[model samples]
Target: MKRFASITLRLLISGVLLVLLFREHDLFADIAPRFHSLLTNWHWTLAGMGFAFLSLFLASVRWHIILRGLVPSLPFPMVLQAELISAFFNISSVGVVGGDTYKIMALSRRLPGQTMPVSVSLVLDHLTGLISVAILFTACMLARSSQWNEIGYDMRMLITGYAMYVGGALVGLVISWFSFTPSLLAWGRRTFPRTMGNPKLTGLIARLTQVHAVFALLWRRTISAMAVSTAMHAAFFVSFYCGLRAVGGAAPVLDVLTSMPIVDAAASLPVSISGLGVRERTFEALLAGLAQVPEAVGVSASLAGWIFSLFWGVVGGILFLRAKHAAHIAPEAQCA
Candidate 1:
């Protein structure tokens, strides 16, 4: 019943977001014009692809670093495959929270005995990435406040509210990090057995402890992974800039680099499925005035980004599947 309710709500939200994204007739008319002009910017288009590939590779490195201690013998290529597969799942889901569960599952299947450690590595990777993104968005919001001021009151308020939310989230994360100890979970189990449910909650509590312990052992590596992830994020923003230029929008590259993360974070809301319509709507809403271009141009830029991501993600998926197949074959061949 609970699962059904959740799926039903997600479907409803997806429908609403799609409507919001496509309801603007003027926007669609602008897309053809924007696409026609932007298609000519082959240089920026290629640059975007390059940056995206670099970003993916860097993300793979981050994962490798995280797993180095736990699964030291695992090949970098295999880890890269996992990263790509994870990204593919994330894009496919388009929900607020996607990919991590799939990623953990994939890693567990591939690494066998290293499942628990790999899962811990992923948790640390995700936590640090989330913190970095929140910090980046907050910084970008503060830096771009002046430009937003020239736009209008509502825009300013929206940015302000978003900043506050990010700020709160960062603080909350810090607090949780400090408070997340084994004792806390034990207390929770005892205090709220009804809410906590059965063995699943108990298992989860044990997993959290194990994750924290593993994290302590790999803190240095985890930090290194986060640094690589940050670089990758920067590369992704640059890709978005190229996409903007491709669409004939003469937006400042720095502005896009600074603003893109927050734009993406906002679009991550459950408003649209797999970020379908939300991506277009977000670009239109934020970039239209700032770039001094038609909303259609912003929409085109967003679509271009989605295109680059999907293409690379597909490449990753092929590699991931190949690696998985090889892993399966290797043991069988040895036995034979």
Candidate 2:
């Protein structure tokens, strides 16, 4: 029943976005011409795909670094495989949680006794990636503030709020690095003996303290991970720029840098399957409104970008299926 509800919601959101996207323009007429134009500049399309692949490689490397920090003996190849499998699930499933669950389960099976730390690492990895996105968005906004002054009030407010969010995240990371969460837990137990009498609550507090300690231990690695994440996201942005050029769109590189993050964030909201219509519409809006590109060109570039991602998702699907088969055969082989 829950699955049914989720699917229904996803379809509804996708339907609404599709309507919005095609309302002002002819879908077939607009996209077909731009796509045909892309064939003329096929080399740029290949370049975009290369950049997309590089971004995925960097993402796998960043995750491997985080996993290794938790389990020093964790092999890079294994981590990379797990990352690709997760990406497959993320693209194939209804939402991103499916991929995260797959990743945690895969790692937990491989490292039996360290599920808690593995889970913590995954959470930290996501948080750091989010922080990097926020930082990048803020930086780009500031860099183009002069040009953005004429943008709508809503956009200005959104940028300002995002800047505050990035600042808050940075401060939180610093506090967590120097925090005495363990001591705080101890003090809470001492001060609230009655409350601490509940084993479940006590256990929860203990786990939180442990997670916090691990997080602090990983502070240095988090910085490096964020740096890699920034590079990875930049590569993705460059890929989008290449797509725009391939489609003959004249959007500025900085405009793409600043706007793509917003479009990507909106598209990742779990409202539609793999962002689908949401991504196209957001891309169309940002590119047309901010960069003065044609809506058809913007949508075409977005579709091109999606095709690049779909190619990777297909690769990930093959890798995931292979991993599943290997896991299934391992015990049978041992018995034989």
User: What's model 2's lDDT at 127?
Assistant: 76
lDDT value for model 2: 0.80
**Maximum-TM-score candidate:** 2
**Model 2: clashing residue pairs?**
none
Per-model C-alpha lDDT, please? 0.73, 0.80
lDDT of 1 at 101: 77
Residue 133 lDDT, candidate 2, scale 0-100: 87
State the displacement of the C-alpha of residue 180, model 1, in Å, after optimal TM-score superposition.
2.5
Residue-wise lDDT of candidate 2 within 191-273, one digit each (tens)?
98899779998686666566677767887887899999998898988898888888878777898998878788778887898
Candidate 1, residue 93: Cα displacement in angstroms equals 4.2
Regions more than 4 Å wrong, model 1: 1-20, 26-28, 93-98, 141-151, 182-204, 320-336
lDDT score for residue 301 of model 1: 86
Top candidate on lDDT is 2
Residue pairs that clash (backbone atoms under 3 angstroms), model 1: 94-274
